[model samples]
Each structure stands twice: as C-alpha cells, then as structure tokens.
Target: MHSKFKFFLFALTLYFPFTVWSHTPSDSISTEQDITPVLINAYFSQQPILGLTSSAQTINTRFLEAQQTTTLLPAVNTVAGVRMEERSPGSYRLAMRGSLIRSPFGIRNAKIYIDDLPLTDAGGNTYLNLLDPAGIHAIHIIKGPDGSLYGANSGGVINIQPEGFDVSQNQTSLLLSGGSFGLFQEQLSIQRKVDNNYNFSVDQSFTRSDGYRDNTKLHKKTLQTAHRWQYTPKNDLRFFALYSNLGYRTPGGLTRDQMEENPRMSRPAAGPNPSAKAQQAGIYNKTFYGGITHRAQLHPKLSHTVSIFGSNTDFENPFITNYEYRKENNLGLRTYFSYENIDHPQVKWQMQLGFEGQKGWYKIDNYDNEQGVSTDPQAKDNLDNIQHSFFYRAMINLYTRWTIEGSIGLNQSKIAYNHRFPEITNASGRINFGGIWMPRIATSYRVHKRLALRGSVSKGYSPPTIAEVRPSNQTINSELKAETGTNYEIGGRIETANRRLIVDLSMYHYQMDNGIVQQRNDRAEDYYRNAGEIKQQGIETSVWTYVLVPNRQRFIQALNVHSSASYNHYRFGNYEVAEQDFSGNKVTAVPDWVWTNTVLMSFPKQFGLNLSHNFTSAMPLNDENSVFSEKFHLLQAKGTWMWSLKNKRQLQIFAGIDNLLNERYSLGNDINAFGNRFFNPAPTRNYYGGMKIVL
Candidate 1:
C-alpha cells in the first residue's frame, strides 16, 4: 500500500473513535438537506426544473463546500458534459460540451453572467478565476448554443447567483484552511437580511500556495459585496462589486520522457529557450468589476429590467520570449421588456424583447524580457472593440402540460487596431464581421405526472477573441472568420413523486463550419487558424437521489448520491492543413467518455462525509491524432463535524484528501504543443483540513 493511503487510514482510525461519541437524540436530524425540486430561470422562464425546454443543471452551495473550498473545479465538474481544469493553483480553464478547441487557456466560446450582468467582455473573454468560491451561492448552466437569449456563444451559458440573493437570515462566517504544498486560505463572509425588503452580503478572501512543481507559486486576494433592495412594492434594485489582485507563476510544459523522469521538474532549458524559472514566467493581474440592475413591474401584464456593468483591468505577463502589459476597460448594458398573460388559466403566453451591447478599449505593449524585467520595447498597439445583439422570444402553453417557444437574435461585431511600434502603411485597420442571424425553436410536453420530454434546434455563432486575432506571436490575422454551427438536441426528465429521485438525459448533434483551432510555432508562441468543418455528437445524463431519510436513532442519518456521465463522438470533417488531411480524426483535447460520481453521508451529531470519484478516457493531443494521453481515475474524500453553540451559532471542522489513489496525470495539458511538450502533471496525493465558525 502507498504511504499516503496508510497515513490516511491511520487518521481515519483516530477519527472513528470521535464519531462514536454521539449527541442528544433531540438535536437536528442532519446538516444536509433533502433532495428537492427547485425553480430555475432557464431561457427566461421562471418555472420548476421539470418545465424547462432546454438541457440545464444547477449547482448549490452545499455541493460546492463538500469538496475543497479554495477552488470551484470539483463542484463544477459534477455536471455532465462540462469540464473545468486548473494548470496551477490560480490558473483556470472551462469548457461546455466540446467547445474546448478554441481555448488554449482561460474561458472562450462561452457566455457567462453574474445575475443580469455580463461577465464576459465584448471581446469574448472571461476571467472566471478572479471570484472567490464563498461569494457564489448558486450556478445555473444551459447546455448547447443559446445565442437567441445570450449573445455570441458556441458552447452555452452560465449564470451565477451571488450570496445575498438567496439569504434567508443574518449570519457571519469565518473559515481557515491549510493543506499540502504550503497551501493556506482564509475567508470571511457576512450576510444580513435587513428587514423583509433588503438584504446584503460581503465576502473577503486571501489564498496562497507553494505549488507541487518547481517555480509554481500562487497568491490571490479578493473582496466582493452584493446588495438587493425592494425599494417599492413593484420595484427591485440590485448591485454587486468585486476587486481582486492575483499573481501566479507558470511552470510551463514537459515532454513525455522528461515527465517520466521527473514530473516535479519545470520546463527544462532547450537550445535557445530559457527554463521557466530562469525566465521568471508568470502572470499578474489587478482588476475591479461592478454592476447594477433595476427591475420594475410597469403593469400587471407588463414588466421591464435593465442592467449596466463595467470593468477595468491591468494585466502583466512575462514569458520566455517577451514581457507583455495590457490595460483594458469595458462597459455594457442589457435591458428587456416583457408582456405576459398571467390572468388567463386555460392558455398562457408571453413575449420578450431585449438588447445587449458592449464596447471595449485596450492598450497593449510588449518588451524584451530580461528575467522578468522590461527592457527594450518590441511592439505596441491600441485596439477597440464593439459588439451588440438584438433578440426576441415568444412562448405559449396550451393547458399546463405543453410548452412551445421560439426565439431569434441579430448580432454584429467590429474591431479596430492601431499599430504603434515598427509601423507600416495603413497603421490603423478595421475588421468588421457582418451581421448574422441566429434562431431557435424548442418544445416540451409533460407525458405524465412524473415524466417530461423536450427537444430544441438552435444556431450557434462565435467570432474569434481578441487574443486569437493577435496572438503571442504579435501578428494580426485579417483573414480569420467566425465559427458557426447548428445543434439538434432531445432530452427527458423523470422524477419520483416525493422528489427523492430524479434523472435527466440529453443527446445532441452539432455540425460546425470554420472551426477555430489553436496552434504553436517552433518558438513556443501561440497562434490561431481555421479548420474546414467538424462534427460532434454526444449524450449526457445525471442522477440525484436520497437513499435514506434522516432518522435520529439511525447511525447513518441520511444518504445521498449524485452521478453524471458523458459520451462523445467528435471528429473532424473536410479538414486539411498544408499537405496533411485530418478528415475523420478525433477532436483534439476532448475525451471519449467522462464519468463523475459523488456520495454524501450524514451521521448523528451533525457529522457528515463526502466521497467523489472521476474517470476520464484517453484523448488525442494533436490534430493528426498520432499522439494520445492516458486515462486516469481520481478519488477524493472529506469528513466534517459540526457543533451547535449558544445564540444559534455553530462551529464546524473538516478534513479532506484528494487523489487518494496516488494517480499520476495532468489536470490541464498544452494541446498541440510545440516540440511535443504537452504534459503538465497535476499534484500527487494531497490533504487539507479546515475550521469554520458561524454566528
């Protein structure tokens, strides 16, 4: 047996003695809540989960806290067909369905919103890692293309609800945690429901870690606040603000041989390229983002909502080839008007019209990197981007069992750049992507009291991001085109009458043209190109159940299980590069199968246990499909004990282990990397322990 597993078993023996010490039978049944149906705002419909005409999933706070509190990867990965990865402590990448192609790092080809505010900028980029996990109360995900409601996406949409919106009582919490690799984290949160008409929440967090690999270190601090006010009987106002300062070192990638020799080593120095440590490769960012929204009911059948948001960021990155700095500013607005016939019971209908727009200004400068110091200037540029979309949606229900909906959107985008250093003729140039129309139709029918079926056909469109247009190589690509696709999907939901068991299944086929692909040069600099065509088909399913109800006399007070799985058949079509044809090749970076399972057990005396397992199949690393990555399994476990205090206060302590099987794998890999340097090994077996106090 592995030494780590032996130590973990010994620790469990010491803890089992404590579990036997039970509390009074009159105490609370269990800290875990029963699995119940909840209302969701999917496709602008505020209805129960069973009435949706789209593939959707929701993640709550309890599920998030069951794993590590420092990162959202574990919680988000519980959703089928969704993948989130972290190359290092503070670096994050997210993908919905098979949209991972265009993204080398960060979030792309997807739309993200916090409440009604757009978190993704006009240039189609999202800084998802900046937000602390404690500040998020819930997440709602809509699978497949949703361009009719949200603008410009091929991957889907994610809406995050902050802490204050769901608070039912006033509470303050402080959490402190420490784990392997010199990891330390602290978070303080305060949520107050000031009377019945107003509520607010504040969250502050700081985290630092000396990572498992050489030259990989991370530190971040964040402050977030949210406020909601029912100023009048028919009007409501909401505001949210966040500030974050983050810095992390990049360890780079290693070859297969190098990894086998020493997975803990950073990228070694090649002929002309310096090692990651010698070059001081890292990324630093200081950003501030905020937004406000107002919702009013003009009349019984009419309503309106408007939101305004803005953000400013100062970013610095030092790589082996160059040192780059960027200053970015963005502002946007979203407003919608709705008309509904709520008074009629036999037949109901609704119509909505909305507009979303955003503009961004950016300044970028590159200099020679002399071990992280800025030396002679290399390149400089000023760029501006503007994007907008107008959309309309209509829905009708015949009786309360059948729903039909249709929607359309018109989008336009343009970019202008002025080259400053090493200038040439027409130093200023503009690229305008003409107007495009996206449409969607969907329907859902409740066959019986416990079953429902739904189907949808939607169009997907996504333009190249700013980083893709002018990649690290510092060259502009004027010939690149936007990616467009159409998706056909069918899904069903089944639930037990008591809401104790629920299952969701969905299947989709997406055909895309002008697919964006990421590439790297011999110098390890990134670039982008367009693939001719691609085809993707997949099936996703999830299950949630409560196997045992809470009982005071039972040793196992409650038992809950949640599982999700995905099967993908993704391949290239009519794709050719130079002299090589990749037609019928498997899509790079996407696995053929992925499965995740989680089990939660609640015992007497407010004691809880959680176990999670994830399995991923092998995937291709390059477009040619000549090289592949190995499959791996991950196991994680956590245990918690809570005690009630005076004045309705509480104290909790938790300890957890990740990668209990001591697997060797990469959480994030550099796909299609230069010189076959693809692997970035994840941490080995690790452990964490934390304490929290609530008042």
Candidate 2:
C-alpha cells in the first residue's frame, strides 16, 4: 500500500526531529529577522525559506478563521499537494498536483495572484469564487510546476494576500454568522493608519445559503479595498479594489442511483425540456477589480516592481438548455527588475527581470432556455485574448550552505474567434499559439541547523482556456493545443533542537504532452480533447507540532498538531479515445489517498479548540478505470471564545461542526460524466455559529 505509506513517512521523519514553534524569540525582531509569512510572501521581494528551492505553502488567514468556514475549502485543504472542491455553494474547484484533469469547473491549470495583481485571465481562467473568504489575509502556494517564473501554469502558483495591505493598529470589525442549511453571514472591517505614510483598508461581505441541496442556492456580495503608500524610503505604493456579486444554484449531478436515491436531488430531466429545477438553473456574477502597485529602489543593488491591472466581468448562466451571457474585459501589466550581488559576502547573487501582459475581451451570448424565457439566438461570439510573458530569475548563495536557482519563461498566446452568429457560417475563427519555453533548475542544501535539502527541475506550459476554447459545448475547438510538461523533484526539511517537530517531504515526477481531458456528450454537452499522454507521480507530507503545558493550573495551554499527506500515482500514457486504448488507465480525478488532520487546543481563558480529519481515496470516474468514486471520511469541529475588552477591544465567539462522520461524500465528482451523472452530493451534518466584534 504505497510502500507501507512510504515506510511510515520515512519512519516518522526519522523519529520526529522536532520543529513546530511558530513564534518565540521576538525580543523585537532582528536576529536577522525572517518571520516566515511563507517566507515573506515568496517572490515580489521578501525571501527567506532558508535555502529556498520550490514547493511552497503558506496559509494564515489566522488559520483560516478557525473553521468558521466560508469556503476556500477549509483553508486550501490544509496544504499538502493541495485540492479544494466545493461543487456547490458558488462552485469552486482547484487542484494542483493532479491538476483536476483539466478542471471542468472553474479555476483551471492554476495561476492566480491577488496582491501582485493578475487573477489568471487572458484565457487562463480563474475566478477564485470572486474573493471573500473574509478578504483573505494570506495564502501562497506554489507547488508542482514552478512554471519557470510563474506564467503559463500547468497547475500551480496561487498567491492571494489581501486584507487591506497588512493592517497594523487602527481597526474596526464586525461579523456575524449563522448555520446549517440556511446559513447567513455579514461582515465588515475597516482599518486606517492614514498618517505615517498612508494606509487604509476596507472589506465588506454578505453571504447567504440555503444549500445542502435542491438546486443549491447561494448568494454573495463582497467589496474590498486596500491602499498603502510609503513614497519614500526608496519609494512604494499599493492600491487595490474589488467588488463582487455572485449568485449560485445549480445542483446538477446525480446518479449513483440518483445519489443513492435522492441525496437531495436536482438534475433529473433527461429527454425533456425541463428540470435543472425546471430551468431555473443558476450562476450569475458581476465583478470589477482594480490594482496599482509600484515599488522602487533605483539602486541599492537596484530594485523595481510595477503593476497595473483591471478587470470587469458580468456573466450569467441559466442552463437547462442554454442561456449564457458573458461580458469580460481585462487589462494587465507587470514589470520587474532586481539585481543584487551582496558583494561576495560568502558569494551571494540575485537577479530577476520580468514582463507580463494580458489583454482580453469576450462577449458571448447563447440562448434558448425556453422555460426560463430566453428564446432563440443560439450563439453569438467574439473572443479575443492575448497573453505574454517573459521571465528570468537567478539566485545563488553559496557558503550560507549552498543554494542555487535559475528560471526562464517566454510565452505568447493568442485567440480570436468572432462568430457573430449568422447561423454560424462554419464558425468564424482564428487561433494562434506558438511561443512556449519554460525552464527551471533549483537546488538547496544546508543539512543541519535544522536541516534542509531540496531539488527541482521544471518546465510546464498550459494553454487552452477561454473556457477551454469556447466551451459550454458551444464548439470552437480550432484544434486545441498547448499543454506541455516536465517536472522532477526531491525534498526534505526537518526540525528539532527544541522546536517540537516539524516535517515536510516531497517527491514528484510529472510528464504530460497534450494532456487535457474533460468530456461529456450524450447531449449533456461540454467537451475538450487531447489526452495523448499523462503521468504523475507523487508523495508529499507535512506535519507540525506543539505540546507545551508547563503548569499554571493547566487547563491545556497548547497542543497543536497539523498534518497533510498525498500519495497519487496517476496514469494514462499514450492514451487513445474512440479507438479506446486507454493506455495505462487510472487518471481521472486522482485519488490514491489524500489525507489531512488537525487538532488544536489552547485554553485557560481565551479558550479554543479545533479538530479535523479528512481522507479520500477511491477515484477514477472514467476513461475505463470503470466508475469508481466513493471513499471518504471527514469530521470537523471548532470552538473559540475570546473577550479581552479594555481599550484594545475584542469579543469573539465561534462554533462549528461539519459532516462529523455523517459522510455520504462526493464533495465534487462528475469526472467524465455523461449519462451516469457521477454524483455531487456532499453536506450532511452541518452546523456553525459565530460572532466577532473588535473596535
């Protein structure tokens, strides 16, 4: 069984070489300060993950708001090869590592960013559920394909760090929440500094549900803002804006005998003209974004950064037959420059040179949902996309226990369709895709002083998004291309020496050559091809620990533990369709054990508690791995209490529970579904409670 779970995670990291001690030794910073906010937000200047060499993870939305879940799938699945899926409640899908076999939902071949602009567009979709997980305060994952310097993306790279540009001091807050099926939420936040070189922040939220099934309803609203300016100490500026409005409802997959007979049905009407809840099928969105950033230092070993962004979207769906409408717009720019040479302080070096560009335009339209009143006009298109990338990176540091890095990226993308429906005369078209080049090399070493060892070799490129070349079965394929890959990795990390146990491990192998699949056609429409090859290998692990009790009437004052695991072994190489050669099969929605665990406590007044568990295994819902999908175990719990009111104001309360072993599971399925509908049920025992107020 995966070599006895990789020899029990290598004998439990060689018998737990201690590591989890988040903070200690902060006598006002300056022991060469490096407070790991995922290594100071990795890239875009802040570095320090010791010898750094790839595979990243950083999440701290205050530990995902202690599970008062507002989705982001429980804080990005507690990171370990990452996977997040929420097939309903404003649908979201994310995968990195197994890459969701060309995601049939949102977020595809990942590459997202928030503070550093670009939320994956210009054809590489990513609507990260339109922000509002309380405006995320941090998340930085970069796993698998290091896309040379983050451009194309063969599933990896996500950086969201929003929450008013790092607040510190002036504050205001309010939050309320309710639970079970008819959940509700309201939130507000405000921050200000406005002086010592400007600062401001704002956040707004509203949420609604009634979900647990039956055309799963959901509603959302968000508004976010951040502003910061330093304008001097070598220059700085930052600004961001966001607005969102979303509407959901689309309970559409079922058949595992209608999810074992009504797991809250919705998706039944086959040869008829109704259902999808009689055509009230859902999805509606509205978005607007803005950005501006700049950082400078002219010379002090030279530095520079720049960003400018824009976005607009207005989408609508309605589906039982069709009623789609979109209107998107994009604009982007990113610039970079960096150069360093610590003048041989043991030989150090740094380099970065960058460019990024985007341009998008879409204006789809399709109609014919007779029940929801959208008569004829079967199609109307107008797409336009352009993406550009240029990247270079170099890092070197020897003597500080070795480190090396190299990177490269050069991409160019294109699209243009324009079929203004005149009854679609052969689908007017244009498609250009040619430039691609990606490369990477990494190294790290520093065995002991807490240990480290890393390695990497990378290359990946993805393309074919514009909703997978005009999807929704609207047909625009134009010989879909682009999906290259190569990756190899090795990893290690250890800790002890009084840090209480921390571990990380990695192993990877990836291969791809035109691997993009997503299909369905017995009139359930949706299509995508290429799957000539595919392969993936994996093993990932993570752990963190804590214990601490040392007296004080002991009502438990610490006891954390965190975990993550993955073991995939995907397949399908030299695949064939129609003529059916499924090569080595099994690679359909990956799963070969994925695990997560958590436990936390902390008491004595500010009380706290957390417990979690997750496990998944059975998978392969198609490509002849013959219908599989069912294997789950989940449990959750949360609790909190805080009330320190006297000037610095505070008052918190929280509660949670979810599927506490009431697992009927299928947090998202539909892999290669057509008729067998492939279940989507998920959500059984639920509960929630909340409160927050800080002024």
What stretches of model 1 exceed 4 Å from their correct place?
1-35
Task: Count the clashes in each prediction.
Answer: 0, 7
| Native-to-model Cα distance after best TM-score fit, residue 385 in candidate 1, in Å | 0.9
lDDT accuracy of residue 405 in candidate 2: 81
What's the lDDT of the predicted structure labeled candidate 2? Answer: 0.79
Find the number of clashing residue pairs for candidate 1.
0
TM-score per candidate, chains pooled: 0.96, 0.34
Clashing pairs in 1: none
Expressed as tens digits, the lDDT of each residue in 430-469 for candidate 2 is 7988888898888989887678899988888888888888
**TM-score between model 1 and native:** 0.96
